[model samples]
Target chain A: MLASIVNPLILGISIGSILLISALGLAVIYGAAGVINMAHGEFIMLGAYSTYTLQSTMGMPFLLCIPCAFFIVGIIGFVIERNLICYLYNRPLDTLLATWGVSLVLMQSSRLIFGSDVKYIAMPEFLSTNLELGILNFSTFRLFLIAVALILLFITWFIFYRTRLGIKIRAVTQNKEMAASFGINAAQVYSITFAFGAGLAGAAGAMFGALSIVLPTMGMHYVVEAFLMVVTGGGSILGTVFASTLAGEIQSIFAFIFNDTMARGLLFILIVVLLRFRPQGLLSTGSGRR
Target chain B: MSFTRRKFLNTAALSSLALAAPNLWLPGAQAATSLKADSPIKVGLLFSLTGSLAVPEEDSTLVMQYAIDEINAAGGVKGMPIEPVIVDAKSDFKVYSAKTKEMILRDKVISIFGCYTSASRKAILPTVMQQDNLLFYPTCYEGAECTQNCIGTGPLANQHSFDLIPFMVDNFGPKVFFVGSNYVWPKESNKNAKVWLERSGGELLGEEYIPLGSSEFGPVIEKIRAAKPDFIFSTVVGASDIAFHRQFKQAGLKVDKMPIASLTTGEIETAAMGAEYGAGHFLSAPYFQTIETPTNEKFVDGFLSSPYGKNGYTHYNMEETYLSAYVFKNALEKAIDMHGVTDVTPRKIRDAAAGVKVEADVSPEGLVWIDGDNFNTWLKPKIGQCQADGSFKVIKEAADHVAPDPFSIYPDSGKCTADGLLGLDGKLKVDLI
Candidate 1:
């Protein structure tokens, strides 16, 4: 009987690991720029595709290819921002539409080049095994995912809190004009910030690809969930982590208790109520929006 | 050695008798007894190759190719070679509908084969029904649907649930718990399952449902443990199903004591779950990738050699899609022979299919026949259990080659049950005392 609770909880944590990695990047972008990066998930797709191409075409081992995937997606993100995003600063809604367009283009390109077939990454040796602690069963890869996410999150948190660049970025986010007057070079900062967010998403994509089947439209499917995370977690980084873990647990528990449709419907209702009561997410600022 | 003998006999027969496949020849060329065989027959392969269903869709597409190659290598199907026109539905229901229409109307395919999920099937149905085109649906699904123009090559509910209930009742002694993803499909499946479970002298400990793609299975598993049913009848679907199964195993539940007999969990899904998590699953599908036979061996060999096949994507729906090509071919040949039709008209091809009895080597069952109602009899469900080596072992048979009773009574349709599970007929097979 105790096994029952521990099993679902472990599974929830595994799923949460994936969600947190994927959502953290989107959350960072939105938190920093207040620009809802709709194409955030696309960066992950690009990363996955990069890994796919490297593995299938170049015959590179996946271990050697992970960083390559990250860098390639980072470059793509940087390129996209430098070319398209720089023109639309201060226009959040337009940025949303523009990023949405970018997402469509990326998805279409994947279909065109890859023929829309499902592609998979050879799961690493460590990923395909399980670990047990007493009665609690856990997947090694999922635990590894949590470890990677925590490291990246810490690095990002440290960069945002301790660095001179971090202060400048916050200044730009809070007041771009003032930051510009202070000679902070907010434009370059925004560009790097966007690329940095994209890289994290790329890393998430690389990890997710190894764990699950990769397809062209997987990005859009994840984008919705990421949006949910950003909305539910709001602008608070700590809150995002809390909500991410909470949402994962709630979804898992509800799924365990009821039929999937009812569980999801109930969760949607719960989120709505959460929004009404808190006006943001459960851990978000009041009237918090994605 | 037996296979070698069979091949030898085939070669000897080919040389001794200048047998012409009359069905494969063109009208004017039939007088010559033998015909030319250079031009390949191009058939379109459509599946949700992207998005949500892409995993299974890719599996099916690869399997389809494997089957086509296997058939063609054996001197082609009825002396006509095959060419695959592949398209991806991208897991969009609209794409399935529109692209299928385009394949039939504009591309003028000989026959169309693809699609695994219900959403894709439903989206593709109206277009096929309206156009009266031929489609071979290759997935185990709810039984309420029937299309005269389509042959459901996968097991329907009656073929699966009715037989399963009896088998479980005899083996486990009539105690069950029905768990499913709550939707039209599972609800309908549960209703049918209850009727059978009660009739088979079994007790339903509990029935529960969850949303589609749900990840948790704790609360339900706890309740199940409390009820202590002999086995679980599950119909969970998608990625979340993976999470549930993983969690179920993680929870330290006694799987050996209570096996999960599921509708949605099949060879395709097991491969997706990967070997580490896929063990201990017992499932039933119309066909499985691991059935040992010449046809299946050839199918497996071809898949293992292919790009996607190397990764162990031998899924149920994928193999079904692969077998469906042969089904379409057999039907078309019969139609053309019977009607001298060359245009690939839907009515003509469908009529031809009704006349043909196709035998694909890789079928879980040895043979399949299409009934006059456009329902296939050969697509019988085969029981499988996941083994350590990333494959399902065919442990048993569901029926003596079950034929779909398309005209069975539906509660919504006011149709009564067909041949009863209580005795032979479905009528008078109520759950009441």
Candidate 2:
């Protein structure tokens, strides 16, 4: 019984870490930019496809493809923001609609290019093996994902708290007009932030694609969980991390007790109830209201 | 204009008439003789061309077109060519239902051929029944359903799992774990599996279901490890199947140690998931591309030479789709001969479809014949193990055709019902040759 409980707990931690990594970019963009970017999932999909293309066509190593995917999707996101999202930022509803439309366009374009077939990325042999410790057996790729999630969290924290660029971005996010008056280029900060968030999504996509088969519609599968984590976490990076961990643990425990379907149903109901009590989320950064 | 009773009635009548205009324009009662002999006989191709299921459904569409081309090349079906009105369902059930109605009422297609998922088939069933149209469903699915308006041209679960479960038990160990996506096909197939496994004296270790399109299998794999089942019986379909196989391989579970026997995995999946991930996996189907027969050789060669075949590899679903189109053509010819050209309706075609047989020489799969009562086909069962090259090496095959038992009544009750028809207890009366 104890072994059973311990195994699920470890599994929960791994799943929570995955959720945190995937939702990190969405949290960053929503928290900092105050724009509900509906195309976030598609950006992640683009990252996976980029990794697939690079690894399959160019013979790039799996590890190298992750970062390459980041830059490719990040640049695409940067251009999209510069041209489209930048214009609709003031109107959040319009931004939501525009981003949703952009997501559809991206999904269809991917279908057209990839021919709606499943593609796979080969992981390194070491990552494919399992790490067995007594009663607990975990996948090495999942362990790698957890480690990457931690590193990402640290990097995000360092950027927001330690760097000058982070400070400027934060200032802009707090009050764009005031930051502009103080000589910070708020538009540039927004663009860079959007690009960084997209890069994070790309990184998530690379990991996820390696975890599963990459397809044109792969984004839709992960986007729901990403949105749930972001919304539950209140759009703040720290909040998202906390919420993902909590939700993951709760879901895993519930699944262990009942079943996966029931656990997910219960989890959704619990989230609704939690949202009813805390409409602003678990932790809201008092900015981006306007 | 605001509150007059006569004006209100007029407006309501006009709106109702506008809403009913589309249905009123339906040419349902039109005679087949009205179609010119030179003009093509319109048939609806309602397979999903886009969305999650497009990978498999695209093959069905391609094979259907190939069959039409084959028939057209042979001086047409009695000199009347078949023109397919293709519509993409986009992997949505509502879209399938809508398209079925549109094809029947507006396009006035005589028969439809398509639907990969059972949900999509079930969604369009009501529309097909209400419109009195015929549908040739070409994918193997969970059975126990027999409808007059549709004919399933693929093996049912009994034809697949009954022979497979005992084979696995005899060769492999008895302890089995079943996993599948949380859906009708998987759930129903697993239910049939449990019965067959128990009958074969195999012990079921555990059963689990993950939501469709779930990427994470870490917890499930851990659970399977704890259970230590001899082999996994997987009914997991679509994207989840790829994820499970990849993760299972990544976890260093050797296929030789504990192989997965599946009803769904075939050439298309093996090709997509790569040979390494699927090597040594087992699959049960009526057809495989690697099956060496002169007919299959010609079919594969013809397909490979064609433009549609260049898109991707052919699988069991594609073969079934190809077979279904031929079956429909045979039935249509018989119907046109029995009933005059003017009287060729869905009912006539369905009536003539009874006992319609495609001989071994023409069909890629040895011999296939439609059972009129159950609307399922008699197909020879073959169990194969996947090799490194994304093709199956047939390990076991039935000596003769296994009759379709969608309800699995033969195994449940030990009575032989000579003909290939259902007995009193909703079971197939097994005929001993």
Candidate 3:
């Protein structure tokens, strides 16, 4: 009985780590800029495709591809912000529609170029094996994923909390007019912030691409969970972490008691009920937007 | 009646029109007067050219075209070239229904040859039945319904599980776990597998269904680890297949020790998941590209020469799809020969298909014949282990064609006949009971 309880908790953390990695980019973008970026999933897809191209054409190692994917996707994100997103600032609905359209375009573009075959990312031989600690057993690659997620989270926290650019981004996020009056280039900060968020997603993609098959529509699977985590966490980075882990644990426990399908259905119902009771979300601020 | 120059030309045209008018209405016309002697016989190539299911379905479409081209090059079928009216279903069931309608009603295609997933096949079922058109479906599926309008060219439940389970029990231990995507096909497949397991005297460790296209398998993995099944009978389809294999490999599971005996995984998926992930796993299918038969070699060579066969790997689905076109062609030719060219119709061709037998040299898989009883093809079930090159290494094959039994799960359920399903008590039933 104790084994059952402990096992689900550990498995839940593993699941939560995956959810957090995928949702980190969405959380950063939404939390910092208050922009409901629907194209975030496609950005991760692009990161996967970028890694594929670099690995196949340039013969880069898998470890090298992760950073390459980050920079490549970050550049694309910067370009998208400067050209498209900069004009839709403060218009949440318009941003939402535009990003959705962008996502569709990106998906179609990849399909046309890559054709619809599933692509694979080769991982290191050691990472492909399993790791076991007594009753706790799982994939070594999954443990690596958890480690990567934590490192990315730590870097994100450091950038936002310990850096000068973090203050500018937060200041602009809190009050765009006041930040602009204070000589902060709010547009530049938003651009950098969006790029950084996209870069984080790219890093996540490199890991995810190794975990599963890489395809044009792979983003569809992750984007929903990412959106759910961000919404449940109230668009806060730390809150997303806590909410994702909690949700994962609950889901894992439910699955242990029931089955996968039932657990997922119950999880969705619980999320609905939780949102109904706490409309502002788990740890969101109870203040109106400036 | 002034016989001027203009009047003479008008009189001549009227006389020719009157002479040709009877040929249009006469059923006994010696030739196809409705079409020019060189006009092609139009058929619809309906498949998802885009969207989630496009990967394998698109390959099916390409193989269909290649088959049509081959038949057209060899003096065409019954001296009439085959013209394909291609349409993209976009992996949507609604789109499948609409496209089937457009093909039958507007394009006037003789038949449609497509559909990989059972959902799309069911979606277009009503359209084909209502229009009284023929559809050649070439994908393995959970068998229950037997429709004359739609001919199944792939293996059914009996051909796959009946042959696969016994082999697995003999080779591996009898403790099997069932895992599949949450859908009708998977559920029905598992249901059939359960019956097979019982008959084989195997023990069921666990059964789980993961949502389609879902990548998360952490909890499911934990369950499987705990159960310690000797082997897994997997019906997971699409992208999820890749995820399952990759995760299973990463979880330190030994494929040689506990192989995934799959109905869905093929060369395409194995290639996508990488050879390392799929290596040593078992797949049950009717055909594998690595088959060393001279006929398969020629077929593989022909596919490689085609534009879409750049991947250089073909599997059961593509082989079945390739042969379905030939099945249709052979049936049409037989119909034309029997009833004359002008009297050939979809119904006549569908009826003639019951008698059509494709020789082993013609079909890469082997001799194939449509079972007049259930409208499903007789196929040889084969088991192949995944190799390091992402291709199957054939290990076992049935000696001959296995009769398709769509209602194999229910022993006394009735057999499909011309009149309908006929039960054991000499009573006629409308459908499977």
DockQ list for all candidates: 0.23, 0.62, 0.65
Candidate 2 C-alpha lDDT tens digits along B203-304: 998888999989777667767777888899999988889889988987767788789999988997887777888999999998998889999999999998
Docking class of 1: incorrect
- Listed per prediction, chain B TM-scores read 0.80, 0.89, 0.90
Please provide TM-scores, in order, for all candidate models, with all chains considered together. 0.76, 0.93, 0.94
Which candidate comes out best when scored by DockQ?
Answer: 3
CA lDDT, candidate 2, residue B307: 82
Q: Single out the weakest 10-residue window by summed lDDT for candidate 1 chain A.
A: A281-290
B281-362: candidate 3 lDDT, tens digit per residue: 9999999989998999999999888886876778899999998998988988888878877667676788889947888998
lDDT (C-alpha, whole model) for all candidates: 0.70, 0.85, 0.86
Q: Between the candidate structures 1 and 3, which one is better when assessed by lDDT? A: 3
Tens digit of per-residue lDDT, candidate 1, span B37-147:
346666678876667676667777777777777778876756778778899887778788878767765565656787776667777776666555657787666666545
Kept native contacts, as fractions per model, are 0.17, 0.64, 0.85
Model 3 segments more than 4 A misplaced: A1-4, B1-38, B423-433
